[model samples]
Target chain A: MDELNREAESAPLIKFFTKLQPLAPAVIELCEAHTYRVKIKKNALLVCPEAVCSECLFFIIKGAVRGFILDDDKDITVWLTDENNLIGNFRNPGIPKMNYKEHMQALEDTELLVLPYDLIDQLYAKFPETNVIGRKLLAIHYHISQERSILSRIPSAEARYKQFKETHPLLHFRVPVKFLASYLGMRIETLSRLRKKSKQENNLIG
Target chain B: MDELNREAESAPLIKFFTKLQPLAPAVIELCEAHTYRVKIKKNALLVCPEAVCSECLFFIIKGAVRGFILDDDKDITVWLTDENNLIGNFRNPGIPKMNYKEHMQALEDTELLVLPYDLIDQLYAKFPETNVIGRKLLAIHYHISQERSILSRIPSAEARYKQFKETHPLLHFRVPVKFLASYLGMRIETLSRLRKKSKQENNLIG
Candidate 1:
């Protein structure tokens, strides 16, 4: 984490600074200088529920983050955004009642690119480069969510886990089993059994 | 439908072109003067799999369209972008496997604001307003997909329908019962029963 994200912490936009996308050099420098980098230790709260969502976007420069809701006394993991992906709440539908999302939490110690939601809105209003990246990122997120829905529809637990592993090999490696289980819409025990079955199959094949 | 959407068939952006979010006058005029109107008969296909996605976007000036894929011999409605919501596949992901979506079809005879995808991308690259709206539109779509995930997680069918009705009342009225049932992760019979129960409960309360 330290090696991958050393100067990444000093200039939060450093991860994106060297890269050429839709943003201009001056604007990129300005962002690199202005944006803040913050660290959250494992199990730390990044964004609490009903907190007005002041800064609605984040990036995992290093480590991982979890988005979950407390429904019927169960903490359900909704999304696990890491690496270059953006994490945020839905600004439309005007928020929801019974909003218990503990959005943006550190699954491991994490470095973040924190931008004010309104400023990002302004950037989208001001920059075309940002807009292309923004749309593509949203497209990526939409694809992930849709795949999860498709997985949930499939009845077999092993099949669901297999699909998830095939779709997100990085997630299975980086994230904890519990988080992976929930994200796949399955119970921990079911995931455990599936993993064991999969291991045996691999061993036999080998 | 005709009375409710007088401009639907003729104006491509009538549904979501807000004065509050206006484009440059020159751009707006360019759009209005050159933009062709599309009136698709019921079940008309807008874009199909294996076809290059050249259509920039269609604003439902009137009527409805569904974006879906055939998965395991079933048509899965991934999106139902209605009036005021933009629809197009500017970036279709198909590197691993080519076909992802089957086609977007007019649920009824529809009027659409037709902007070629290339023109919008070019304009979006040059203009801030186009980029802002494009990103904003993607944000909404992403949010809806997340909401759909949350709805699917509800253990009870009734609770899922309640959440759907509360969050997207528009879909209940505009979308076909079958699609609504599918989106809600329930059977058509179940949704019908839920609607009936909801109506009776409302009547009693009133």
Candidate 2:
């Protein structure tokens, strides 16, 4: 596209950024220039383990994805996401080198707005306000990661399921039970049993 | 307390900030004006669950601290830190309010440089380049959290132990076996056996 599409597709992303911090017109224009939309088919790999450092961050417009690392031939789910979220290489883009340690697969047909890492670095360097957004996003992600770290170490299966359900009420039903179980650090069977028990309790309450 | 202490105590902190990015004389001066050192006695609470939002971040000059949440009367370790590390309320200081869900305690007599949240917010507002340091720090903390998330999900106790020892070689011997076991999501007994097995293997190999 020769011209910037600011009207429709970029509106949501602009909203996302402004919600974090107001952007100068110049910063907005820069972002509008570099960001573009991508639609990924269901089961497509958004980020493969062998993928080179694309060094781009994705803002989830719609659909779902999972981040996992392979261990002993098994894919261990480390992160799960849906709409209105951001995912990236996670390595600092300012650094000269990076290697992908996780694979990101679209669990459903996905739409994302891709922003190049170089643009982000440029924005931070060129605009002071942009760093507020950068800092806030990183803080949010760090807090989330810390929560997941705590969740993984939680001792009780029921507790873990409950916490997951509470935090991801929509995803609880949307995501396949197996992947959810893996993300919760439990076996599929255990999660299934917990779900059955939870459903029964909900039915009684209802 | 009346005047800025720029010479001796602040050197390590200035060095730390400069390593992230060369600070402007003004930003550097502002930092020196606000940051001061505190020494915490061993076994004392640096941050308690009921502790008010101190709104101060600690850069660990020496000793160790663990961040844990009370679950069913059990304090589950959520984070562990040592020298040259940062620990805080983990809440965005820009926010008007916060509630502490974690307790931080000094594992040994600890020294730390305290930087108030207000000064941090001011830095991001006044000096654009300071945001780089903020972004970089958050990225690092987020990456660390992500790694911990993965470590907590690793299935095998031996694998977890091996990974922890590899990553935190000094912590392996320095931290108590129980806390390390808890952090690794293994019982102390299981960790002891793993350690015994590891030592035996090393001995045979040696």
Candidate 3:
């Protein structure tokens, strides 16, 4: 096999593997086809809050997903996963068991490459590159978690939104204002005011 | 291979895997060997924050490990990886092109089983079952990141401390009050007061 062709074949798996480093072809191929490729309609619930998430991690192959938690009929978006990104409600808080306390929903009609925990486990046990993949994925989730923490500590809500947009421009078009507001830990009104101010400052809108 | 020996070989790897899991033997063998014995003196730094972590992950074969985030002069203990727990900042947060901002230290004279990331990656690519182990490890890290988020939102400092103890009693004894206090998002004074109040509540101080 030519070197270029070999690199090309392995590129897709490693392209997203910007962390923990690249994987060998064997680890990438360990992925089974049983991970059903499905189309989810806009606002379709992939997993409901407090529900058990059997497949908590999957790639956003062609659409966007919002992973959020519910509070008193309100949805507070925690993380948004756009195309080429990964999303899920695989983690729970104050709980001993592995369960999902948040929900995942499609922001648009989405196509995803799903990797279930069961199969991932199987692959992880057998493949070393998959282990690297695991580490890279963990790094991603960690950054997002830290972003949330930093946003909370930054004090000004406007600064929070600015930071959010700077770090996650991919989310702006996908998530609606109300959702974005809540995700930034702000009220819809505060978000609206900030948006108006930001637009005026940038000459984007008057 | 005899069933008895195989069982002995696979069990340690299995302990770290906390999801729908089973490990392939090649992975188990790789993992078992990669885990080399090491010791640290009390008050010694096991892992310096901001260095590219060459260590794959350290299993607390025995002794205690305190993983902390240094904010200015203060060290906030975010996690404690004790007996049977495998930990490293790289796996939890991902190490892509460096820029890590945390440190892990020994709270006491600690014994560790250190594995290099590259060695594990090689094993996973070669062994089918280890791929599953890789995925499971990610699951565990993902869970930790999620819990940090949830715990941060526990509304008050006192509640966070309560939850921390409930979840990580093993770590509480070895870790100092101040570090644990910072991790709970509280001031040292508040933690001291809480401990005093708790001691008085049961009349144990007398």
Candidate 4:
């Protein structure tokens, strides 16, 4: 049963890689060879502050993770990730030196495909097409970050909330309210009021 | 004299690409082949809001550029780039359908090597090693963006100013104070006062 569960979990990751479409066969083979399957328990810290990030990229097979920073007695959520998402410090590929600006924790019992940075370097050396995949993926992530940065500059909190909802509709269901509130840069009270108001309006529309 | 000046300007770009130690020789050749030299007058917009960004990447050979947005009748500077920097909407690689969230303008008469997005795609298909270069470059840019996001969360404008100066010392001389003030999320008066206070403190230390 355990073996069967593992196979079932890893299936999604295979699908994810296959969907990239443009990735060369050798690059795909490199991914399959290098990636290791790992299971993390609920609330386990995947990444912590004050240390260089582990030279690994994680592909979520199942479960959710939250990235946050402890700021002046407050935990500010920066990002949330779940199944089918890739998470890692994609910043410093050389020397693998990156001070952990955020803490990443598994929100539930999580299954992940962990690919070491060295493997990626090897692929870069051997399979140049991997770089193209890397560029496309990074470009998508950059776009998202740029969009978020733009949205944050808007003066209205309500507008920001709406934008967030529009962009990440699934997050509201998966993430804890407190963490979601923090991610949105709003007080819990405001989040609660917004949720209540939105629910009531939804009911009226229904 | 004009031809000599062009050669001198493009020399730096060749040096920059050569420094990417891991890049294969063929990949470098691809870069050389695809890159187009262009000149822009001071204050000319490179990117504009709501338009699909041009399918190109720019390597600055000379002068500076600023990325900004208009918010409530005020221009908010989001980023500044100078010599030896790469600038582009690294968000979209195909179809070039990226709505510009910020306006990018040449702050001075600028020389750039513009590589069309299609050329990169071609390199990915032909050279393969170009993928590694693309990945490494994108990773570096992503890292910088992540660092900025972390810095922006800090509450103190003074602290942000110090951090900005520490990270981008050269920008102080190149960027206009008004734009820099906006980028740091502070008023011009506040920035001026902070600058004066810091200068006085530096003199005392000196």
Candidate 5:
């Protein structure tokens, strides 16, 4: 990549880091040096279910990605993310006796900044400020994972759809209905019916 | 508590910490100073549904705890943990504008070492080795949360129950059928029937 284009590519991540905390320029420079940008085509597998767990952290600069698993030979969406968010294996690669069986795929042509786990460890050691951002990022994903867990346990299909809409205002529309249904632990037909019923209610209100 | 009794109580946590990574004596002493043990009676609420998000992590030394939420006026179990594990708000307390709504209750008389968030931050600042342990713990919980999310999205009730049993062999026998059913996202009757069927199959195989 050209120097100017590389600088432009790193802008979003720089903005994200500063939004988390104001850091010294040196720390940002270090991060910039350690990270690289990549673009993934739609439906491209970033992490395959059969492959070893992903070892790098991904910061989505543009487009979207999702994590899903195969259950009884059917695809079940468990995670969805878009621009300005982080994605990758939830498992710590250093931890032994753990299995990571999820697949990560691009929903759209996606741009991402990749930071390897080794660089992350270095950042933690070299810069105290890195820890805050690390903790915050982990917390954000941890919260999302917990909410998804809670959402899946909800009994009513309509209620689950409503809560999902409320929580993921943009995601409900971005992904396919089949994926949305699988994520909500319901069939596509059920999601379609609920959407139709909801639209009718909105029309009446209007 | 007497000094000897305190030492005995701290032994389990010390062992857990060392199992993650060897730390300096001073670091262990710092952690010991910041933590205190508590015992919760069975059925008592450790973190109530109506209360604010729990601010302290409970490192369970004995017995069991379950995290649940009220959905459509019904208690739906989302998290269940036992001895030698940590439980608390999955959301970072420092993260603004996030709501935690789960209820944490002791399923049996539970012994725990409570580590408040402030002290956790202090430890992070004081001991470099603390970061490894912290990351490992978060990774463990994040993996669990992801698995739970995936479990809830499984279309087959029998498959969900079987996976849950395999993941938590001891827990299935320890908790009541109703809670287990809710955690597995199925009706109590459904779980009971599945259990009965599994038992018959096991007998046949035997």
Candidate 6:
């Protein structure tokens, strides 16, 4: 990427980190030095099932990615990431376990900042502040995972869909309905029916 | 607690931290100064629904605690922690959101080292090495949570139970069967049936 283009691409990520916690100039410089940018086409798989997941963490500059598992030929969506969100397999690098039985695929043409895990480790060793940032990021991720686990047990498909919509309004427009439905642990038919009913209700309100 | 008893109790926790990554004497001293011990009786709730969760991270010394959510009188177990594992709310202190719609209950009489979040923050600010330890701990937690999420999607109850048993042999003996069944997202009857079948198979092998 060219200088101006690179600057534009990194601006959102810089803003994201600063918002999480103020990053020192040195930390920012470390991030800039260690991170690289990539663009993926829609439907491209970022991480594949049974493969060693890349040790790099990704910050989405634009577009969306979805994580899904194939169960007896059925694709079940596990998670979705949108602009300004980070996505990566958080498994310990030391463990020789097979990569998770899930694939991360781009839902749209996407731009990402890839920060390799080795560089992150280096940052932790060289800059203590990065470790603080790392903790904050992981805490947020853990909180979200816990919330998703709780929501998965809600027992009502419609309620689950509504909660998903409320929590991820941007994703509603960015992700296909089928992926969203599966992500919410519901049938595509049920999601369609709910969408139609919701549209009618909105029309009546209007 | 008496000084001698306190010292004995904290030794395990100090060992746990040192094992995660070496802690300087000053850092260990900081932890010792900031942490306190708690004894929870079996069946007592450590955290309650809609309540502000204590701003303390808990290191399990002995016994078990299970995190569960009540849905229309049905208690669904989300997670279980055993000896040497750490548990914490990890919710942003500034966010007034009720600390998750879940409660953590002691499954057995439990001993814990409670490190207040503020003290942890101070440690991170003062001791850079603590930040590295914090990140490692969170990374492990994040990995486990992701694994659990993946495991929950398994279609067969027996398979899930088998995986659970393999992964948490100690918990199988320590936690009640009902909680285990709930944690596995299976009916108690099914869990019972699976257990009997597995026992019979083991007898055959013997």
- Highest DockQ, which number? 2
DockQ, candidate 5, vs. native dimer: 0.48
What class would a CAPRI assessor give candidate 6's docking?
acceptable
Query: Which is the winner by lDDT between candidate 2 and candidate 5?
Result: 2
What would the TM-score be for candidate 3 when compared with the true structure?
A: 0.64
TM-score of chain B of each: 0.76, 0.89, 0.78, 0.82, 0.88, 0.88
Q: Which ten contiguous residues of candidate 6 chain A have the minimum total lDDT?
A: A91-100
Docking band of candidate 2: medium
Error of 6 at A183 (Å): 2.8
Q: Among these predicted structures, which one has the highest TM-score?
A: 2
Q: Is the docking of candidate 5 incorrect, acceptable, medium or high quality?
A: acceptable
Cα lDDT tens digits for candidate 2, A63-84: 9989888877777899888888
lDDT of 5 by residue, B140-201 (tens): 67777787888888899998898888878898799988888989889889999999999999
Model 3: CAPRI class? incorrect
Which residue runs of candidate 4 sit more than 4 Å off their true CA positions? A1-9, A22-34, A47-54, A70-75, A91-100, A186-206, B1-9, B22-34, B47-54, B70-75, B91-100, B187-193
User: Could you arrange the candidates by lDDT from highest to lowest?
Assistant: 2, 5, 6, 4, 1, 3
TM-score of 6: 0.86
Kindly indicate the candidate among 2 and 4 with the higher DockQ.
2
Q: What is the TM-score of chain B in candidate 2?
A: 0.89
TM-score for each model? 0.79, 0.91, 0.64, 0.80, 0.90, 0.86
Per model, how many backbone clashes are there? Answer: 6, 0, 29, 2, 0, 0
Report the C-alpha lDDT of model 1 over B63-105, residue by residue, as the tens digit. 8887766656777665565666567664633122123553688
Clashes of 5: 0
Which ranges of candidate 1 are over 4 A from the true structure? A1-23, A48-56, A90-102, A117-136, A142-158, B1-15, B48-53, B92-99, B125-128
lDDT of 5 by residue, A97-197 (tens): 22337888888898888877767778878885676677666666777788888888888999889988877788668888878888888888999999999
Candidate 3 structure quality by residue, lDDT tens digits, A115-169: 5676666765665456556655755676666545534434457867887777676
> Candidate 2 lDDT, tens digit per residue, B1-206?
55434546667888888888998988877878877778999878885222322577888988998888777777788777788887987665333211227778888899988888877879977887787798888888888888888888888889888888887777678777777888889899999999999999999999
> What are the iRMS values of all candidates?
3.9, 4.1, 5.1, 3.6, 3.1, 3.2
lDDT of 3 at A150: 36
